[model samples]
Target: MHDPHSERMSSTEQRAAAGLAAVFAFRMLGMFMVLPVLATYGQDLAGATPLLIGLAIGAYGLTQAALQIPFGMLSDRIGRLPVIYFGLLVFAFGAGLAACADSIWGVIAGRVLQGAGAISAAVMALLSDLTREQHRTKAMATIGMSIGLSFAVAMVVGPLLTRAFGLAGLFWATAAMALLGILIVAVLVPRPPRALATREAGVAPQALGPTLRHPDLLRLDFGIAALHAILMASFVALPLALVEQGGLPKEEHWWVYLSALLVGFFAMIPFIIYGEKKRQMKRMLLGAVSVLLLCELFFWQFGGSLRALVIGNVVFFAAFNLLEASLPSLISKVAPAGGKGTAMGVYSTSQFLGAALGGLLGGWLFQQGGVDAVFLGCALLAALWLAFAATMREPPYVTSLRLALSPAALQEPGLVERLKAVPGVADAVVVAEEAAVYVKVDKLQVDRTTLERLVEPAPAC
Candidate 1:
């Protein structure tokens, strides 16, 4: 029979996970809503050159990358809800500013402000605070799905919205969404429960040293950066290519985006399932990276053919979705238990940095070398990522568990040693003042019943 405690824990964790994901999706939707239409829309504004248009499109990423870590640290001091509310307010302000802008430079400034609202790191840290260690991976996965869904929706909706109401209207809508998000934060999300609010002793700092010094973690971080860079760079070129070479109108670009997203979603599921269930995550990741490289190569080879471009887009998005979902999980698995938050903070920062650089660099490259050179740059990034990815060790599946014990129990000689010796327990640490035990265990082999029995009510009590 299944344990009721376990079931109840699972359900609560799922709710918290879903709630956090909704928050992320709502925020991302506002940002992504402009990407598909930005290049064309910028033409209507004053001083709208290709470089300025690219700046408007990617400026948010620059601010986001710069502020992610600081926002996370701020959350640690001022609390998650306060930081999130501040971010939402900043985002709304930027949206409203962009909506009123008559110049491309003004819009670019607004986008930079929008990016400064960077709350992803805070959101992830909040998830860590709310959920048990055993369920953190599942929670993060839900957030990943929310991001992917938001991106897909934004790609389809961005062009249509641009056609229907124009760029200003879209920005106004985004402002409205951001305002709504603030309401959700206030009315919907629960206050952090007392048990979850208690900090564990011995948890290490999540700093640049730990995040960047580890070879494997650094590899994953670089991959995320490169992946996002390619994505942003592709957007800089693809719209013009579609209109000029594919003979597609600007408004009809939505159809291409919708089709690619749909096809990619369906095609990626089998590979993702295979990776998780068959323990072939490493191999699948490498394969996905290879597919991305191939897509870049194809784009380079068939720059003028609409059919070939569409095919390449489908393959690219499929791989992009797969990597987006898997990379965080891989980071969580491989990171030291004490520093997962730091590793993720670093990863998120790198991702936005890449986005910012992609747009700026893509604009320059497109202007200088045209479409072929753009794809060549993307291919080179993918090649470097593939090499680094190939060298990474398969991440072991482990989960962390937090247990509160009496001071006497902790003082009991060899208590931690005994826990460490338990069948699946990989490591255990006892924090005396907190009267807590942090345990790392292999997911498949952990015997919850055995651990629970050890902590059962004392005879006198």
Candidate 2:
């Protein structure tokens, strides 16, 4: 048996992981930079209504939602880098077009083209293709952290960048970043050592049934969608509210965002630690959703007070950050061992679609009844989610592990049970067709050395 430790990440893996994470960050930053200021700068565009402004803000999600899965599947058939390059080209073109446009409709058209790039899944797949199994989790986690960091940076930078160059300048900068991503893919990311012999790691048609029918996973999907919808939808009114209620300058809003985000993030740490340590994830999750509902109510109650607005920002973001960090792990716990990727793809698609819906609906509400109406809508969303989520069972206190397998393990009828018998393993599933076994285990209880040996097959005579 090949020593499990022998598969340490090579230089190529190190470079690929770093390069791909940077690439994902660049693209995400471009999309997010507009969020904090769109309601303000969108006013300068021709024929802009509150509704159309909201549509432009979210137009990218419409195309992104429609194409995310198809691009992932397409990458499998055609090749990862080719699809990525083409998508980047579309994004750059869209960004450039938006930069040059004078009208809101033109910006909307460009955003649709931008979303047509839809290369997130392809990039993630490329990350998988480039890294060893042991390093893949670390690689994916790095990319995830980059995304979260990018959003925080965009909040602060968007207003500053707009102050310097106006909204079109932001679009031009996005186009430049997209071009840089193309260069990164070509130069920084290394080609896989060999062509993949199978598509097992990619989402498959067979996994669709089990993933689709899952009640708990579906609830998580709804939660993610609701999360993003509230996020985008709130932007439709948040900035304007800050200006009208607090008498703050438009650019000055960044201070509120940056400070609130920092405090909110720090506030979330203890909850996360306590939830994990005590196996009380369900309780904290419910608490977070309830906080979301209250945040909206607080916004309505104190929309006119500057001090209250700042405090409200901190609390709202605190709750948002908590749920944002927790939801993915919750979904992973509920997903079928073999169908994790499919379930995540659906989750992502729902998230993008929710953004589109929220922007459209949120804008309409603001136009009809003002900030109070917008928050009321968000509160209703939170209420609905709370009602459904209340039915969910507590998340298992386990983390997932992936181990390489050999063909011989497929013929061992009792292998899964034997794996399950391992003291710390809550369950095990072997995908013989994929030459991999996945397990859920409590790290505190698992005997690491024993599990490592089991992951490798017995040497043949």
Candidate 3:
């Protein structure tokens, strides 16, 4: 019998979840900590063009985007811990290299290496291995919230750390954090249960094609890409604008970041509630995009005033938070049966690619014109994204459920049809090799008794 909501994680599961979330914090904060101070400190590096500086900020994303899927797939071949250990080593080395870097290009190279340590998919897969199915969502949510908190902390900490110890010191600190992460994985995280060896917790090559082909998923992918790119590009110009135009000192940048983030987080609460309670996610998404566009327009027009800068950031952060929180939910709702991981993998890739491009373009525009050019570039991207978002239809009000089946049931004639014929099952995918059925069901219309019988054991002769 499925426990559903009654499920409680074991002690081992809770420890594994928290430890893994810490690993994500270390990795993500390392990347995010440089965003606030890079434009200013990077100016001193050799051959530093605004474009090259921007690339250094976002280079990690490019490499991360390229490698995450393959890295996850590789973890399936080797043990998850070994792959993670190796990735952490790579990340630490990258951070150390950046710490010693003398040129913008060198920093860019180090950032690329930092991204090459792609371990997110592997980490999530390991989390799945360590938890029960009913508890997996909670475990994942823990990690998700950890990543969000890490970003917030980084925004506040980055400027202060850079002021105290320079850019290299920040990189060195990140290297140390990576080593700490390695220790966490080794000592605190438990090995996966034996069932994980053959489980479909990691990516399957077959799921890639269908996930890519889905038009609705493609729109969300593009949406994430645009969002991150604009975010990266905005920051490229934002810090310098606050310093030069707004007259805020570099050390005080944390005030802007912390305040904006706090405001945005609170401001987004109602929208999130509405998104869930009213099922108006599509409306919320479009509104958020429009808010982003308007924020960029404001920055472009009145970026010089300190007050205007604060207002722009607060509004920008609010929209950013809303979209960030909404996107994964939208992806979950839209992905086809048995293909959510694959869909998310593509979505993550899109996001990183956006970051890389956004940084590079923002820099180029700044070089060609000035701070205003970067704002204009961001505005243009937001406009296009808003249009793309307009085309997205409301997602189905269905939930995906996984059911384990006996092999005999897999071979039974009309099994797929029988599952589909169950009230409110819109789609059924039976992966015969896995002896499982992945069903998309509208719970409001589904008959619970009929659904329960599909997964019941066969009667003895």
For lDDT, the strongest prediction is 3
For all predicted structures, in order, the TM-scores are 0.90, 0.94, 0.95
Write out the backbone clash pairs for model 1. none
Residue 112 lDDT in candidate 1:
94
TM-score of 2: 0.94
**lDDT of all predictions:** 0.80, 0.84, 0.87
Q: State in Å the error of residue 153, model 2.
A: 0.7
Q: For candidate 1, report its TM-score.
A: 0.90
Judged by whole-model lDDT over C-alpha atoms, candidate 3 comes out at: 0.87
Pairs that collide in candidate 3 are none
Poorly placed runs, candidate 2 (over 4 Å): 1-9, 195-201, 447-449, 455-461
Writing each residue's lDDT as its tens digit, candidate 2 over 300-373 gives 87778788888988998899889988887776676666566777788888889988888887889889998888
Candidate 1: tens digits of C-alpha lDDT, residues 232-280: 8888788877887888889999988888999999999999899888889
lDDT of 3 at 258: 95
Worst 10 residues of 3 by lDDT: 193-202
- Cα lDDT of model 3 by residue, 1-461, tens digit: 43544557788889999999999999899989999999888999999989999999889998999998899888877868888998998999999999999999889999999999999989988997887665776888899888888888999999989999999999999999999999999999998854252223556678888888898999999999999999899988999999999999988999999999999999999999998778899999999999999999999998888899999999999999899888988887888888777887898899999999989998999999888999998999999998988998998767766676776677777777887877788887877776777777887888445665776557779
lDDT of 1: 0.80
**Candidate 3's error at 327, in angstroms?**
0.7
Candidate that beats the other on TM-score, 1 or 3, i.e. the better one: 3
